[model samples]
Target: MSLLQSQVPGNLRLRSIDGTERLVGYSPPTRQNHGVAAVVGFEEQELLRDIKRALLRGVLIVGGGSLLALGMTLLVARRFIAAPTDALLQAARRWRAGDLAARAPGAARHSEFGQLAGAFNRMAVALQQREEELRHHAQLLEDRVADRTQALREANARLEAEILERRNTQTALLQAQKLQAVGQLAGGIAHDFNNVLQAVLGGVALIAKRAGDPAAVARLTGMVEEAAQRGQSITRRLLAFSRREELRADRLDVGALLVGLREVLAATLGAAIRVEVEAPPALPPVFADRGQLETVLVNLATNARDAMEKGGRLTLLAEPVTVAAGDPGGLATGDYIRVTVADTGAGMDAETLARAGEPFFTTKPVGRGTGLGLAMARSFAEGSGGRMTIASKPGCGTRITLWLPAMAVAAEPAAPVPAPRPGALPARCARVLLVDDEPVVREVLATQLADAGYKVTEAGDGAAALALLAGGLACDILVSDLAMEGIDGVTLIREARRARPALPAILVTGYAGDAAALAVGQRVEGSFTLLRKPVTGAQLADQVAALLGWRETV
Candidate 1:
C-alpha cells in the first residue's frame, strides 16, 4: 500500500493499486458508489458535490476515531498481561533459587493489573517472613542438639560414679564380714580360756605368800594378779561379743544415766565439741540390763566422738515418750524410754543411712571402729523386746535413739529372798536321782553327792532319766537338762513332777549361768530352780546339803 497526493486541498494519499495514479481525500466517501474517478466528471457535478460534503464531514471523523480506539486497546492489553506475566516468571525463578529479596514492578493502570501487583507484593512479604522463620528454627534445632548432648554426658558420668560407689560398698561389706568372723573366733577362745586362767590365778594367789621371800612373793603375786585382772577384762569384752553375759533387767532411770554419761561424753569428745544431755528428769524407768545399757552408752559416745573429727556437739537425751501407732520406726504407742544419742558430726547420706543397721557397717578407717558397738547395742536393746532407730542426713547431724519398752505394771514389792542354798536339807539323806545330758556336768555333780555319802543315780538324757524315775527308782531330786534333743528342760521338769509328785526338781543348764554364780535362783515359769552350769564343787555341796538337810562331808 502507498499514499498518493491529489489536487484536493488539505488532502494526503495512501497509495494502493499497481501503477495507477489515484487521488485521495484521506477520508471516506458518503456515497457507496463514489470513487476518486467521480471528481473529474463535469456532467455529474451534483453527485460530486454531495460526495465531497460526506467525505469532508461525518465519515472522516468516525473512521479516524475507530482506528485510534483499536490502537489504545492493544497497548493497554499488552501492558496488563505481558508485563505482569514476565515479572511473575522472574520472581518465581528467584524464589526457587533461594533469594527472598527478589521483587517485581507493581504499578498498573487497570484493576486487573492492580490486583496482580497486590498479590505479588503480598507473596514477597510472606516469603521474607518464612525465610526468617526457617533461619530461627535451624538455630533452635542446633541449640537443642547441643543441650541434649551435654545432658547425655552428665548422665553417663553419674552412672559411672554410681557403679564405682557400688563396688566400693561391696568391698567394705566383705571386709566387715571378715572382721566379724575374727571377732567370733576371738570371743569363743577367750570365753573358754579365761575361766581356766581364773581357776589357776585363784589357786596360786591363795598360796604363794607362804613359800617365798616377802619381796619375791609380793612381786610374784602382783604379776599373777595382774595377769588375772587383764584376763578378766578380756573376758568381759569377749562376753560382750558373745552377747551372753549376765543381764539383770532392772527398772533404771535412763534419764539419770544420760546425765551421768554426759561428763564422760565431754571427756571423750574433747573440749572442742559441745556435749548436751537433754534428758529431763522423770524419764520413765526402762527395764534394761544396767551393764548392757552402760555399754550401749559408751559405744554411742565413742561413735559420736569418732564422727566429729572437727569437733561438734554430742547430745545424750532420754525422754519418756509414747510412740505413735504405725509410725516409721514400727513402734507401738506405749510408754517407752527413748534414749537418743545425737551428734553434730558430719552425718551420713541416705544411702549409708539405709544400711546403718547392718552389722559391722562403719565409715571409719579400720581399727578406729570395731563396728560391733552398734550391733551389740542393737542386739541388747532388742533382747529386752525393744527397737532401735537411726535418722541422719548428709552434712547434718546424726541421732540414734534406743527405744526401750518397759513392762507397764506398777512397781511390786520385792519377794522374800529365797535363800539360794535350799533351807536345811530334808531331815534325812534320801536316795537322790540326778539327771543331766552332759557327762562332764553329771559327773561333776554326782561326785559331790556320792562323796558326801548320799546314794546318787545319774542319767544322760531325758528318756533315760524318765525310765529310771518311772521304774520305781527312789530319788529325792530330779536334776535335768534344760536343752536336750528329745525333750527340753522344762518338759523334763513337768514329766518328773508327774512321775514323782513328792520329788523336788532342779532344771540346770549352761545357758542360765553368768560367769558369776549370782544367778543361782533363776526360775522361769517357776517349777524348778534354774542352776547355771559350771557351778563350783562347793556350791554343789551347799545346794545338795540344803536339799537333803545333811551336810555333804566331802
Candidate 2:
C-alpha cells in the first residue's frame, strides 16, 4: 500500500469490493459494522488544504491589481475627456447666451478636445466678425436711404419754383410784344396823316379869305376852324400812342378830359357809336399829361367802337380809388384816380384778356385794326406811375380800368403869359424869309405873310436860303422846313447865322428827328423856335409876330 501510495500523485480515494469510501493508505477495518471509514493521513489533508489556500490568495491578488488599473483609467479619462467636456459645456452655454467669443480653455490644446475647442473659437471669431460687418452694412444702407430721400424732396421743391417762375416770365414777354406793335403803328399813322392835314388846313384858310359875303366868310371860317381843331386832336392821339409826345405831367380833371374826348369820338367814331361819360364832379385829379390822358380815352373809345361792329354804348367813369399794397396792378399803395371805360361790344375770351395789353396783338384781322391801343394805354398809365386792368368776357363786352396817381395840389401857373389875338399883324412890318420843300406850302405861307403885311422872301431849299442870306438879303425872321433834299434846315440856320448872327428863325418839321435837331439848334447861341407841321395861317402869323417883338395895336 505504501509503495502504491508513493506511486500515486496525491491524495487518492479507492473503493473496495464493499461499496465504501477509502483512502489509498493501508487502513484496517474497524469493528463497526464492517463498513470502513478512515481518516486520510493528516499530512495529506493538510497538503490539500494548503493547495486550496494558495489558489485563493493568488485570485485575491489578481482582483486587487485589476481594480487598481480600472481606477487609473478612470482618473486618466476624467483628466482628458471629462475636463474638456465640462469646458465645452460651459462654452456651449455661453454661446447659447449669444456670447460668440466663448471657447474651450486652451490648457488642453494638444488633445482632441483641445482641437475641437480651437475650431469652435475660430468659428465664433468668424461669426462675430461677420455679424459686425452685417451691422455696419445695414447702417450704411439706412443712411443712404435717408440721404436719397432728402435729395429727392429738395429736387421736387426746386422744380415747383422753376415752373412758377417760367409761367410769370412767359406772361411778361407776351405783354411786352403787344406794346411794341402798337407804338410802331401809331408812329406810322402820325407821320402820314400830318401831310394830309396840312393841305386841308391851307385850302380851308384860302377859301375863307376869298369869301365875298361877310356872313358867308364868318360861317366858313368857323366850320374850317372846327375841322382843323378835330384834325389836330387826332394827330395828338397818334403821337401820344407812339410815346413821342413829351411827358407833360399836370394835375387835370378826368371829367373834362372825358368831355373833350366825347366830342372827338362823336366826330371820328361816327353816329354809329353811342358814347356816355359818367364822372363825378369832385373826382380826384390825376397828375398826368392832359393830352396823353385824352389820347388814352380816345384810343379806348375807338377800340370800343371797333369792338362793336354792330354799334354799342361806351361808358367812361372816373372815380377816386384806394390802392393797397399787393394790388394786382403793382401800383404803390396810396390814393389813385380810377378811370374806367366799359364798352358794350363783343368781348374778349380768356386768352385775349390775358394778353390784351400786348402790343400788336390785335383781335381784328390784318389791315382792319392795330393791336397797339390797349398796349399804349397801359404803357402810358405805367409811365405815369399808374397801372391798367382789363376785365373782359366772351360775349359780355370789356371793361378797362386805369389807375392813376392822385395829385395833392393843382399845378402852379407860370409867372406871366402873353396873349396874342389870332389873325393880327405886328405893329411894325418885319421882313421875313420863308423856305420850304413843298411848292404849295411855300405858296400858301408867302400869301399868308403878305396878308399879314410883312414883306416875305421865298426859298425852295436850305441851300437856297443860305445863298439868299449870304447874298445879303436882310430879314428879321427866317422860317425854314427842318428837313429838305439839299442842306438841312439845321445846317442852313447854322450857315445863315454867320451872316445874320442876330437872326430869329423858326423850324418847321413833321418828323420827330427834325424836332430833336431843332432842340439841338435852339441850344446854340441864336434865337431858334420849333413849329409842328400842318401849320395853320394863324399859328404861322403869331409865331412870326412873336419873334419880331410885334404887338397887336389895341
Best by TM-score: 2
lDDT value, residue 153 of candidate 1:
97
| Structural similarity to truth (TM-score) of each candidate | 0.39, 0.53
Q: Total backbone clashes of model 1? A: 9
- List model 2 lDDT by residue over 1-554, tens digit each: 54333422355566656655555644444445264544453344544788999999999999999999999999999997898899888988998898887766864568788788888888888988998899999999999999999999999999999988766654555555456435544554454456446655765776767777777666666766666666676666556545676657877888877876675465556567788888888777788887677767877877887799998889988988887889875789999988999988989998888888887677765444557689889999999998888999988999999989887765677887656567544534888889999999899989988898889999999888888877888777889888889788788888887776777788888764345445673545665888887788778888887766642332
The 10-residue segment with the lowest total lDDT in model 1: 1-10
Q: Show model 2 residue runs off by greater than 4 Å.
A: 1-211, 247-253, 256-272, 280-285, 289-310, 321-335, 345-383, 387-397, 411-414, 417-427, 517-523, 550-554
**Model 1 TM-score, 2 decimals:** 0.39
RMSD of each: 26.3, 31.7
Task: Show pairs that collide, candidate 1.
Answer: 2-14, 2-15, 3-13, 3-14, 3-15, 4-13, 425-548, 425-549, 482-489
RMSD of 1: 26.3
**Once model 1 is optimally superposed onto the true structure by TM-score, how far is the C-alpha of residue 382 displaced, in angstroms?**
14
lDDT of each: 0.68, 0.76
Candidate 2 global TM-score: 0.53
lDDT of 1: 0.68
